[model samples]
Target: MPIRVKLDDMLHERRLTLSELSARVDITLANLSVLKTGKAKAIRFSTLEAICRELDCKPGDILDYSAED
Candidate 1:
């Protein structure tokens, strides 16, 4: 995928664990782990909003495009 998820880095920078983020955003740990590992195929707008809200970050901070082969 050209789109890379930077969720792990964001979490580290914010000093938050996946479980903590899940609790704050009301998302399941499995789902958040999928996103953190870049294994998720899609993300709903509501999910994105919740993550951003809890992380105090923008969508771009969680996801970015990488044109590497």
Candidate 2:
């Protein structure tokens, strides 16, 4: 995928666990795990907003894009 998820890096930088983040965002661990592993097909704006709010980061901090060939 051209879009890469940097969730792990953010979690490490913020010293947060996935379980904690899941709770803060009110998202299921299963769904967050899929996103964390770069396996999610899509993410809703509301969910992203909640994550950003809890993590004190921007969408760019969590997601990055690169040209694929």
Candidate 3:
């Protein structure tokens, strides 16, 4: 995947647990775990918005893109 999920890093930086973020973002732990582990194929804009709102961050704080070698 060209896009990398930086969710774990952001969570760590913010000192938030997965459960806390899930609750605040109104998302399931399973779904958030998948996203956290970079296993999600896609994410809805609404969900992204909720996460950003809860985390007080931009999308760039949770996602990154890099070129393939």
Q: What are the clashing pairs of model 1?
A: none
Stretches of model 3 off by over 4 angstroms after superposition: none
Which stretch of 10 consecutive residues in model 2 shows the poorest summed lDDT? 47-56
Tens digits of per-residue lDDT for model 1, 13-65: 99999999999999999999999999999999999999999889999999999
Residue 68 Cα positional deviation in candidate 1, in Å, after optimal superposition: 3.7
Question: C-alpha displacement of 24 in model 3, angstroms?
Answer: 0.7
Q: Tell me the tens digit of each residue's lDDT in model 3 across 40-61.
A: 9999999999999988999999
Which sections of candidate 1 miss by over 4 Å? none
lDDT of 2 at 31: 97
CA shift of 59, model 2, Å: 0.4
Task: Tell me each candidate's RMSD, in Å, in order.
Answer: 0.7, 0.6, 0.6
Best by lDDT: 2
Residue 56, model 1: lDDT of 92
Give residue 30's lDDT in candidate 2 (0 to 100).
96
